[model samples]
Every structure is written in C-alpha cells, then in structure tokens.
Target: MKLKELEQLKNEGVDHISSIERRRFLKLGFLVTGVYLGGKALSLAPLTEAQAAEVVPPKGKYSYSPHYSMVIRERLCINCELCVEACNGTNDVPSYGYRTDILERRRAIVDDKYETIFMPVLCNHCNRPPCVRVCPTTATWKDETTGIVKMNPGRCIGCKTCMTACPYNARYFKEEGRFVDKCNFCYDTLLSKGAKETACVTACPADVRVFGDLADTNSRVYELLHTPETLVWVLRPKTGALPNVYYTNA
Candidate 1:
C-alpha cells in the first residue's frame, strides 16, 4: 500500500491497525526490492588471489579472538579499486553496492588547491549496534563475544527501520528484494571456519585495514583502535549511532 493511500485511509477514519502495520512494512520493502537491488550485480567479481593471507597486527590483548575487527588504516588506503574488486568477488555482491563503500569529503587546499580523498566505508560492527535496537522483528543481531553485527534475512519482515536508525548509513537495502543487507564483517568468507582475518584486510594492496578484538588490550586491533598516533574515527559521531568503525587521517 502507498503512503498516500495509507494516509487517505487513516483520514477516512478507518481504524485498521493491520493496515497501519502493513504500511510500515511496505516503506522498508521498497528500499530492499526497489532502489538498491542492483548493488550486488554492480559488485559481481571473483575474490582476490590473496584471499587466504592473514594479518599480523601489533601485539594486543584481543589478538586471540581473530575476528574481522574493522579498522580504517588512514595512511595505507590510496582510494584504489583493488579492495572494491576484492570485496565484490568474495561476496558476489550481485549489485553495485557489494561489501565496500567509499567515503569522500570535499576539502579546499591552500592557494586554490582542491581535492577529495576516498575512504572505503562498511559496517564497523559496533559493540552497541543501533541497528539491532530498531528492527520490528528480531532480524539484526550483534554477537557479544565477536563484536560483529549480523543479519537474518529470514527474520527480516522487509522492514528497513534499521537503515534509518543507523547513523553510519552502514545498513543498505537491495533493489526489488524484501530484505535489508550490509557487511557482516564477511562472516561467511573470512570467519566461517573461525579463521582470524577477512578478505578485505588480506587483499588490501596498501594494508589500510586491521582486524582483531576490541576488548583485549593484547590484540592489535584494540591497540590500534586506541592509540593516539593512529587515527580512529566513527562516521557521523554527531548522529549518535556509536558506530564501531574507526578511521585514521581519513
């Protein structure tokens, strides 16, 4: 049912609670089945040749967990397309929006210099995931031990409230589908066997990303995430999603 039509029904004094609920479902359904359905197709490709490589992060407490703990290595990423191909290939994204998302901010340089730096964006796998809080159905979840946010398409009522609830804009819906989707730290590829890293971290030509645990001080991911020398940022902190994704100079 259309939003306008729903409103019309409400205006007509139709006290149908089911209609209101159905309207809510349709709002989210459009995002999955309508707008971004082609994202996976845009990302269709083969995994990187170095898909099996492992990262040796600096020593820290969380080193033992070996989850794909997302870290934006500010210095190493040159905005190259290698990781893009790597992610699409690994996931068969089936749409242009595969696993990788590039972030660009316009900046003006001195003496009329102007340029923009491209940074890849994806799910940060926050400790306190807002996406989990807003789902009408219990579709999105965060693992306590791994610190990775996960999705269940089976439980998703095609409601995308999680998308708007997220400040990082990490949650994405597919075109002509009926479910919301986003990066789950590549749990399917890198962590399925309980491995220690992700394809994106392994395939990065410049080694800009890091993976590990957030709680263990012994883990490399945790140390890098906390160190002052290395920059770590959550996208749109003002929005208060408390995103776990961290970025250096970017």
Candidate 2:
C-alpha cells in the first residue's frame, strides 16, 4: 500500500479507538511506533539518484542574512512555565492567548513508572513558511535580515489563513488587536531595543532555550549544531517547512 493509504488507515484507526485507549496508547509512545511502521512501509520503494538529488539544496541558496534560529534543550525543560510568563509580560500578550507554550509527553521508564518530557513549542520560522505563502494580505512574512517569521497587524485582513496554514498551531487570533499574533523571536520588542536575547530565553532558569544567529560560526547555536553524536530535529518535518527551531537532548 502507498504511504497515503497507510496514513488513511492510521486515521481510521484513531477514529475507531476509544478516547481512553487513544490516550493510553499515546502515553505508551504508540504514536511514534505507528509513524515508524508507516515509514517502513514507504521504504519498499527506493528513490533513484536523480530523485534523491532533487531534495538537496543548490549552492549559495541562503535564505536569510543572519539566519536567526533557536535550539530547545528538551531534557532541561522543567515545566515551570516561567518562559511563558516572561513572553506574556514582554509582548503584552493577553490572558486568553500565548506566543509560546509547553506540552507534556509521557513514556514508560520502568515498571509502572512513567517519565514526562516537557516540549516547548512556538512559531518555527520556517525557511519556506506555509503561513507566509498562504497570507492573503502579505501581512505575515519571514524577515530577510534575521529569518524570523513576523506579523504586520496593520496589514492583516482577519482572514486567518496563516493560522490555518501553520502545522504547529503556533499562530493565534488576537481578538482585541483584530489580527493574528505569533512569536517573532522578540525582534521588535527586545532585539530592536538592544537586548541580546529574547525574554523567554532570558527567563528560562534551566537554560532550556538557546536563541542565536545560525549564520555566525562562532555562535553557540552553530557550535551546538556542529556537535558530534547529537540528535537534532524539528517538529513536523513532514510539512517541509525547513524550520529554524531545532530540538535536541544535548
């Protein structure tokens, strides 16, 4: 069967499963297992050299100048939610909305003992952002200087196309402001004000979040990316966004 067929079957299975079973299955890490099985099903068809080469980027195809990126140290997140508070205060975010948030995943570590992983999520600031592509008024765009995905509230038409386009559920409608809102890595509020880092990064006591320029080789983000034997990944890689935000245990 094709990968799409497998995905259809997965969705069908999800629909048939009871809520409690689904929740229990997810807690036991069955979601990853199902995805792995789907990938294995797809591996039956091997790609040719030309087909594989199409996925590679050409030389000197850099998207942004500074290439601002963030690294999430997943193991360090303590779920204190200090970063969320800092973001709310720094950006004047309302109580009903959020620019960033944490999610919890449980995995069985021992007999009846489950360990929790706190995942912090935000706007990925993709190189080929779907949100930017779907914006009808060109209100949301990826910044050329810093590569951060930005929103122009004045230009927004309240269409919410960008909100639907985001796979990570990053964008939210700010009803009072009458526009879509999202995380821009604090470029306008902090970086433009001569701050070295974002409010969330500064507030993270566990040092879970690292924001820096990816284009600079001397930067800590560069060093982290170059580190050997480390697993670096992004959320929703299948979406083909090429996100700047990376997650790793190291």
Candidate 3:
C-alpha cells in the first residue's frame, strides 16, 4: 500500500492483528523462513541462461544481529552527514545534541606522520549495556532481534544515568526536555525484511554504513567482526557500555 493509503487504514483502525493473524503467521514460520532465505540467495546468485535479468548484483547490505546493532562502513563514508540529516528529519533530534554526530580527530604517527580523520558517532547499542544498569528507572532496553538499544521517554526519570554510562559519548539528554534518547537504528524501516535498507543507509552518499546482524556467522556484519582489519574502539574505554560500533582499519 502507498503511504497515504497505509495512513488512512491506520486512521480507520485497521492496524490491529489479532491472535489468529499472529498464530497463522507463526504456523508458517518454517516454510516462510526457507522461502525468504532461498529467494535471497537466488537473487544474489549468478543468473542462468533461462533467467530474465538486466541489473547486476542488487546494490545494498543486510544486518543479522538477532536484534543486532547497525553497522557503519567507514571506507564508504565521505562524511556527507546524510545519516545525521536523515536522523534529524526522522526523530526531530535537537540541532546541537545530535543523535548522530560527526567527530573529527587528528592523530600524529611516529616521528611526523599526521592525519585528520572524521567519524560519525551515535549510540553503539551495546551488549552488557551500562546505560541500562545506571538507569534510575528501567527506561532503556535492548531489543532481542536487532540489538538496537531503545528509549522509553515516558519511563525515564531524567536522572541521566545513561548519559554518563556510555563510553562513546553516544548518549544525550534533550535541552528542552528532561528525557534520554538515542538511536534505535531505524526499527520502523526494517520491518518489511527485504531489499529495502535503512533511511540513513539509503541516504548515504558514499554508502559507508552497512546495516545487519552481528551474531549470524555468515552475515556481512558478522564477517566484518572477524576481519583482520576490523577495529572496535571505544571513545574512552574506561567509561562503560561495551559498544557494538566498529571501525575497519586500513
């Protein structure tokens, strides 16, 4: 359905799916699971003579976190800030306290070698998240499937426990509001479970951010984790949250 049609249906209260709907979907899990994976592999596989095809390999990436966090691909990044802009437009995140911010740092290597590097910083959506522990109220929780940490503004007491707990400085408190918020990695966008990628990923000019699963051994994110060049660095490791964000070393 088109966006307008979907919104109209929602207004008409057609959004609710009852137990029968849920159970019916559950019953087809095995069959649906195979079809989905098989179809994807087929799409990615080389075309046969009988196959009608034109486009080369479909462009984009996937995540497999079991609720895994979003992956950022640094090499593909040109620091365009489309992710930041998309984020601001999507969540209305404050102008200064960005849910995603670009950070630039200069490092001097041995002797005189020096270079300036820029990286986009945001919530790492960690496992063993310290923000969860420091919360005065249980407002932040990690999703099981995507590993994206989310906020419950209604539950937050605005104590700022989470803000202090993050090592990457990914947490932020709104200036006009007394609530904590961070990236949920576009959960609403990924529901279709198809070639459709996240807004930030799609908006990316350099296509640097790769969103997918961290747990599945065969997933791109998973393979990235094992790559010899991959580097997961905390802005300050001493702070807390064992972040899921990583940078590939060239």
Off by over 4 Å in 3: 1-65, 109-113, 175-178, 189-196, 228-235, 238-240
Clashes of 1: 32
What does each candidate score in C-alpha RMSD? 14.2, 16.0, 19.9
lDDT of 1: 0.66
Which pairs of residues collide in candidate 2? none
C-alpha-based local distance difference test score of model 3: 0.64
Q: Put down candidate 2 lDDT per residue, 1-250, tens digits, no spaces.
A: 7645554553544487755666687767877887889897674333121111212223234356677889999999999999999999999899999999999999999789999999999988887788987887889987768888899999999988898999999999999889999999998899999998999999999999999977777888777766888888888777777788889999
Give the C-alpha miss distance for residue 128 in model 3, angstroms.
Answer: 1.4
Off by over 4 Å in 1: 1-68, 175-177, 228-230
Name the lDDT of candidate 2. Answer: 0.83
Best by TM-score: 2
Candidate 1 structure quality by residue, lDDT tens digits, 1-250: 7667756663445455576686788888987876576775543322122112222233443322434466787656687767767777876676645667676767898999887777788886654457876777878877655657888777888767888877667766765455787887778777776767777777787878877666567777677766776545666665444455677753
> With candidate 1 superimposed using the best TM-score fit, by how many Å does residue 164's alpha carbon deviate from the native?
2.1
- Model 1: how far is 81 from its true place, Å? 2.1
State the lDDT of candidate 3 residue by residue for 1-250, as single tens digits: 5645544453344448754565588879978999999997885343232112211111222222364645666555667788889888867778878778887778898889987677777777665567875676779876655666778888888888788877667778876667887877766545444534556767788756766655556777666656674564444444434456666542
